[model samples]
Target: MPIIKLSVSERRRLQVFITCLLLAMAAWVLTTLSGAYHFTIKQVINFKNAPQRRAFKALQSDSVEVTMLGTGWQMLFSKVNTYNTPITVDLHTLEHSNYIALNTQIAQLNKTTDAKHRIVAFTPDTLYFDFTNRVVKKVKVEPVLDIKYQQQYEESGKIQVKPSYITINGPGNVIQNIKTWKTDTLRLTNVNDVVSTTLPLQPAKEGNISIYPKSVQLRIPVEEFTEKTLRIPVKLINNPHYYNVKVIPQYVSITFTVPLSRYTEVDEDFFEATADFSLWEQGYSVLPVNITRIPAYCRIVKTAPRNVDFLVRK
Candidate 1:
């Protein structure tokens, strides 16, 4: 590296130029700090000491315009950060009307600002608030599901909800009409197995409400089902004492599809097939075999020999 050394006369001239620039900068700074400047800032209002089982809703906006007189340096810093510290309005200090005139409270804000700056004026000098009685209630959670299963797979049992319910707190007028909270729509395709997940609850479109425990878990049971067939005997029912009728067919085949869990529980004895003689008519000689009972879980796929001929002996 090559260094270029300056002569004494040249260095003295450079030093004088630097000194004059520093002096001018200091003079400008002092002059700017001496004058007062006006600025508009946003001061958020916080509600504290609210009554139990009560919510405070300010009828107006939560922010206020606070015009203050301050030096240019103070205004510059404040403008850089227009968000001032929040001021508290204690509900315990309000009147029966549930209103607080903030005109008296501005003095408290001035104290929190920079000591060199003066808060000359502000708008909304006063604000109105509505204190509503908070009502808490538990409502059922509804799942919105759109699911498609793959071949040979289907839902086995009812969809189970973990929480089942949610607690909501809001104004009485709004909470009174809330019957249930529904979750957002869930879409799934080719679901071959169980779907266990947590879904977030959607806010009610109509009211201003707050829900606790925002999300709930859903356990969707799934299984594969195979076709099952059973043979059931046809018996005579509601027969008159004078007439004894015997069905031409002694047994009928009942084919159904049962879930694997209930495969052993469903059988011939689990169902009832009977031909009611009372239902017999003169021209209608065909005895209709009525399926009086079947397992609740199994779906009946088919029944053979729906009707049979009967020989009556009196």
Candidate 2:
């Protein structure tokens, strides 16, 4: 191993030679990538222009492997980006035949694609579908809600959906099992007033099912509640013997919460307090007073004198 030092001119020549080699390698790569080539990529399939008179279900998956003819640069980019735009296939051809040949649709499918990257072929080559009788039916819409109301606030009345029912069209076998459709979740927090908004229906799980009017109007009545107390008479129940039974405390004070708008409309007549005499035979000394009925929108706070002494006379 002897140390050898090169002259200044020799070192300069070596540097120039190395630079030229690197430049040639770079030029070769660029030229190769610029040339046209065929490549394969997976693309999602979207069906359009469906036949009007028939319902169809695809026999295969929603995606297909597509062979594309494009420049090497496009192939390089396609490798780096895994997402390929979906190819739309017209189903109007199904009116005559149950199968669609992808090769026949190359021109139509390329309309939305870049001219530089044309569709050469599809892996499946053809698409098949199963047909069934088309049917239309009206189904109720159920709203999904997640709401938090402020203290002393609540819904005053039933929630109203502008179009309570929606029309769905699909294969009779599929539509027969679907009784109702649901809307997307409507979320609200710290709500103290009326809620009115439009919500879109949840998308159909089956691609063949179509819903009319994608959205619906929703109205929820809300109001502030206030406490109200009323003295309601306790009536005896289950006295088949027709014996005279008198409760020691004839009237019980019932306290409940009612919306402000309906405060004046509610009274003792809207409540029914009863004491079951059948408990006497069950070894109870007193009868338990229960609020048997109350308005739908009202919430009971407390019923005074939960138990009452009763007198039985023959």
Candidate No. with top lDDT: 2
lDDT tens digits, residues 268-312, model 1? 889999987776755678888888897655667788989988898
Off by over 4 Å in 1: 1-52, 55-132, 233-252, 272-297, 305-314
Model 2, residue 107: what's the lDDT?
Answer: 90
- lDDT score, residue 227, model 2? 98
Residue 279 Cα positional deviation in candidate 1, in Å, after optimal superposition:
7.4
Give per-model TM-scores: 0.51, 0.87
Model 2 lDDT per residue over 85-128, tens place: 77888888888899999999899778867788889999999999
The total number of steric clashes, by the backbone 3 Å criterion, in model 1 comes to 0
- Model 2: CA > 4 A from native: 1-21, 80-83, 247-249, 275-290, 305-312
RMSD of 1: 9.8
Q: In angstroms, how far off is 210's CA in candidate 2?
A: 0.8
Error of 2 at 7 (Å): 7.2
